[model samples]
Target: MAHERIEVDLPLAKVYELLCNPVHFTKFLERIDDVEKVNSQTFDYTTTIGGEEFQWTTNIIDNLRNTRFAWITINGNLNQTGTIRFTPLDSGKRTRVDFTLDYRTFFGEAEEDLAAFIEELPVQLKKDLQTFKDLAESDTFKDEESSSEKVASEVA
Candidate 1:
């Protein structure tokens, strides 16, 4: 099990909305190559990690608007379950993000391997979280949102 936290420079609702879109996962998650929506709450994804590419499917277990989003991988080379919780801070202009992951590696469950993963996981997680922060603060994401709203308004 590994847990990490990051503060994002965006409103809680905006962060939650961005995260709910699986299309943005690859942008923040390192080595993620593809994401295919299996259903409203399921996704099939491909990732390259440690020089190997594998496929995984994740089923969303719970989503509570801006509070929490949790999921479990049902089929994959790696078995993992994770949750992200959002807390409004700075008068709701920023969000404190909490993330947790419990994973069983594809490698044999040797004590040494598990320990190594445990030690290295935090570094990867921090990098990914920083990537997410950058994306959330970038103009590209804002442009995308504005474009989406434009289309929505036009359709109505």
Candidate 2:
């Protein structure tokens, strides 16, 4: 079993919400083009990489607040299961996100040759997380202010 972890500078709940929402992926994830929500706990996305596109569907296996969420790949060109864990850091000023993607060979057979793939997954994932962190810590993350706040600012 190979493991990788990344910590983005956002609250755990914020990170969890972003990861579960496929609709917001394009704002940071480069390989994912679009996502269609099937229901409250299921979704599908079209992911493109290296000029190749594949459709994948995932079911929400677990959902928790400020802790973790797990998912299993339902249908896709590959087979994998993943988990995202959240840990509070610096007394809520920061959060550590740990993501792990586990998989076997396409035929369910294991071999030593697979390390190459595993080694690169974390690098790619970390870069994506960093981008999200930058966006989250900036002033442009979707602010959910109420109409009264908006009106007051406009009046001012």
Highest-scoring model, TM-score: 1
Candidate 1: C-alpha lDDT? 0.76
Cα TM-score per model: 0.78, 0.69
- For lDDT, the strongest prediction is 1
Which residue pairs of candidate 1 clash? none
- Model 1 misplaced regions, further than 4 Å: 110-119, 142-156
The sequence of per-residue lDDT tens digits that candidate 2 reaches over residues 80-117 is 56677888887776788777766534556434444444
Q: Residue 151 of model 1: what lDDT?
A: 55
| Range of the 10 consecutive residues with the lowest summed lDDT in candidate 1 | 142-151
lDDT of 1 by residue, 1-46 (tens): 7788999888999999988766567666664666777899998877
